[model samples]
Target: MNRLKNCGVAVALLLLSGLTLQAQDSTALNQSEKTIKKYKPFDANLQLRSLYIWRGFKVSDAPISDVDLHYKSKDGSFQAGFWGGASLNGNYKEFDYYVSYTKKGFTVSVWDINNFSDFPNANLFNYNNGSTSHFIDAGIAYKFDFKLPLTLSWNTIVAGRDTYVKANGKRANAYSNYVQVDQVLWQDEENSSLHVFVGGGFAFGREKNFYGDHPNIVNSGLTYNKDLVLFKYHLPVAATAMFSPEHKTGTLQLVANIF
Candidate 1:
C-alpha cells in the first residue's frame, strides 16, 4: 500500500512539472514572436489651396482641396500612394496613383495621372490604346548632396492619351517630357524655407507637342513655406509665385494644410 501511494505522488509531480515546462515554452515563443514582428506605416494629408497649379499650367482657377494617402516602408526607401484634387466650383478634378523607390540621393517613380475634367464621360478602367484618358508618366530625380541644396528631375509621358496629330494626319504618341531644377535659397529648423524652381517641356518629335509648338520654358517659380502652430496643432502654409513664359501667364497661390 505504501509503494502504491509513493507511485501516485510521483505521477502527480511529473504531470505538474510537465505542465510548468510547457507554459514556459509557450511564453518564450510569444516573446520571440514579439521581437521579430513588424508593423506597416501609413500617412495621410489634406490641403486647401487658392488654385490648382501643376508644373507651369493653371489646372484650376478656383479654390481646390487636395488629399493623399500613402504607405511607406519601414526603411523609408519605398512608397506607394494615391493623390487627388478637386476644385470648389466642380470644374477641375484630378486623381493620380504612384509608386516610387529611393536609394541614396536618387529616386525613381511611375505615375498614373487622370484628369476627370478633360474627359467627364470617360471610363476609368478603360486602358485601351487611343481610347483611355489616363496618362502614364515615368520620372527620375537626383538630389545633390551639396550645401546649396539642389535637385534635378526629368519626367516623360510613356503611354496612354499623350498623342498628337502628325503632318500626315495620323495620331502619334507625343512622348512629352519635362525637365526641372529646384534650389533651396534658405531654410531653418522650424520648417521655414524659400525655394526657386524652373522647368521646361519638350517632345521626342519636333512636331506640335503637348506643351507647345516649340520647346520653351514652361514653369518658373519662387515658393516660401512656413509652419505655424495653431491650437497646439501644426499647420503648414506656403505661398508660391509661378510664371509660365511659354503661355505668358503667371499666378500667385496660397496653400494651407488642413490636417
Candidate 2:
C-alpha cells in the first residue's frame, strides 16, 4: 500500500510540472507576438540643400528645396515615389517619379525625369515624344555583403529629350549612360557614416549628347553624414565635397533634413 501511494505522488508531481511548462510556453508565445514590429507603408520628407548638383554638373548655385513622397510594400521589396526639387531663385525646377523593386541585395528601377529649365512652357502631362521634356531612365544596382559596404550601379537614359543631332541633320536618341560605385568608409552604431563614391558617364551614340562626350569621369566625392539632436528633435545632416575630373571643377554642399 505504501508503494502504491508513492507511485501516485510521483504521477501527480509529473502532471503538475507538465502543466507549469505548458503555461510558461503559452506566456512566452504571447510575449513574442507582442514584440513583433509593425510596418509603415507611407513616408514623406523635405530636404534643404545649399546647392543643386547632379552627376558632374552644377544645376543651380542657389539654395534648393526638395520634397519626397514614397509608398513601400509591407515586405519592403517594392517602392514607388515622387521627388521634386526647386531652386530658391526659381530658375531651376525638376520633377521626377520612380518605381523600384528589390530582392536580396539587388535593385532595379525606372525613372521619369522632367526638367523645366530648358522648356519652361512645356506641359507636365504631355507625353508627346518630341515635344515633351521628360527623360526616361532605367537603372540597376547591387550591394555587396562584405566586411565593408560596397555598391555598384548603372543608369541609362532610354528615351525622350536625351537626344543628339545626327550627321544627316536628324535627331537621334543618345542613350546616355552613367555608372557609379560607392563605398562606405565608416559607420557607427548611431548611423553616422562616411562614404566615398565615383561615377562616370558614357555616350552610346556617335554624336554628342547629355553628359557630354563618351567616357568621362564625372562625379567623385566624399560625404559625411550624421544625425544631431537639438531641442528634443532629431535632425539629419550631410556635408559633401564633390569633384569632377572631366570638368575640372569642384564644389561643396551642405544638406539638412527638416522633418
Candidate 3:
C-alpha cells in the first residue's frame, strides 16, 4: 500500500511538473489549443490481420478482422472506445469497451473484456455468477518524452470470471497482471513508426495459465507501421514479428487498416 501511494505521488508530481512547464510557455499553450481545435472527435477503423494473437496466446489460426470506434475529448484528456475482433472462419470473437483519462504523460483506464470464443455459454451480464464472461481490467500507463520515446504500462484484471483456485478449493478472481515496455526507434509520420516492445505477466492469479504457468517473458516483438493515402483514403499497414521465449513459439503477421 505504501508503494502504491508513492507511485501515485510520483505520477502526480511528473504530471504537475509538465503542466508547470507548459504554463510557462505561452507559445506552447497556443499551439496546443490550435491542435486541439483541429482534432476530430470520433474515429473508426477496421483492420484485417493474418492471425489473432494476444499476449502469448495464439487465439485464432485463421485470419482475423478487428474493428474500433472511439471518441475523444477535444483536449485529448479523455477517451472512450469499443474494440471488437472476429476470426474470418468463426473460430474466435471478442468485444471490449474502455474509457481512459490522461494527464500529460500519465494515463489510467478501465477495460471491460468480453471474450466469447473460449466459452460460448459465458454470460456477459453475469457479474456475481461463477460463469460470467466479462472480465474487468484496470491499467496505468506513462509515456516519456525522452530522446528515445518510451511507454510503460501495467494492467491487471480486477474483476469477473478469470479465476484461480484457492488452497481451500474455492474459486477466486485471479487479478492477473501484465506489464510492458515499448520504445520507438524511428518515425517518419505521426501515425507510422518502428517500435520494439517486451511484456510479461506475473505468475500469481490466472497468469499461471495465461502466461504458461510461470513467471517469464511472454511477448516480445518488433513492429513496423506506416500510414499511406491510397485512393484518397487513409490506410495503415503494419508488419510484426513476435516471439514468446517461455512458449518457444514465434509468429509473423501483417495487418492493414481500412478507415
Candidate 4:
C-alpha cells in the first residue's frame, strides 16, 4: 500500500510539473485564449461504471467483471480501475489498473499491467505478464458539435513501456497510434443522446502476434445512452469489437457507464 501511495504522489507531481511546463510554453509564445481554450469540461461530477462481458458468448462459466472509478474536475479528468472476473468454479484474479488524465482535448494514460496470478485457465488468458513496468500514452480527441453531429478523435501515441506477455516475457518499449470517428445517433442537446464510433490503431516497433503483429488494430462499436433527470444520472451502454491482425478471431467487449 505504501508503494502504491508513493506512486500516486509521484504521478500527481508529474502532472503538476507538466501543467507548469505547458503554462510556461503558452506564456512564452503569447498564445491567444482562442488557441489555449478548447473543449472545456466545466462542470464537476463523479461517475461509477460497471462492466460485465463474456468471451465467445459463453455464459455457463465465468465472465469478466470490471469496476471503474472516474472523476472529472478543473477541466482535467482522472480515472483508475481494476479489472478481473469470476467463474462458478474459479477463484480470484487481478490484472491491470488504469490511471489517466485529460486536459482540454488531450489525454494521457498510465497502465500498470500486473500479472500475479496462478490460474490455469488458458481460455481466460490475459496478456499481462506480471511485469512492474508502466505504459504511458498521450493522445487527443476533439468533438465538433456541428451540423452533422460530428466528432473526430485522433491520437498519436507519444510513448509506451512495459507491456508483458507470459510467453515472450516483457516488451519494455512500444508505440502506437489510434483514430476513431464518433457520430451522434440521436440527441436532445443538453439532456441525453446516443453515439456510434469506428476506429483502428497500429503499432509499428515490436510485436509477437503474427497477425496484429504489424501494430494494426481495428475497432467498431455502437452505444446506447439515456439519462434520468430526477437522479441526475447518465447511462451509456456500448458494445465494441476489436480485431487485431496478430490474433486469431476478434475480442468482443460490452461496457456500461453510470454517472
TM-score of each: 0.82, 0.83, 0.79, 0.47
Ranking by lDDT: 1, 2, 3, 4
Cα lDDT tens digits for candidate 3, 133-178: 7789899999999867899999888888767778998888777788
RMSD of 1: 9.0
Clashing pairs in 1: none
The Cα RMSD of model 2 versus the native structure comes to 4.9
Shift of residue 71 alpha carbon in model 2, Å: 1.1
* Candidate 3: segments with Cα more than 4 A from true spot: 1-40, 189-191, 204-209
In candidate 1, stretches whose alpha carbon ends up further than 4 angstroms from where it belongs are 1-40
After best superposition, candidate 4 residue 25: deviation in angstroms? 48
Cand. 4 Cα-lDDT = 0.49
Q: Against the true structure, whose TM-score is highest? A: 2
RMSD of each: 9.0, 4.9, 16.7, 19.2
lDDT of 1 by residue, 155-251 (tens): 9988888887677988778899999999999999999999999999998647455676678899999999999898989899999999999989999
**Each candidate structure's count of clashing pairs:** 0, 0, 0, 7
Alpha-carbon RMSD, candidate 3 = 16.7
Per-residue lDDT tens digits for candidate 2, residues 92-192, read 89999999999999999999999877787989988655688899999999999876789999999999888766779887787889899999999998769
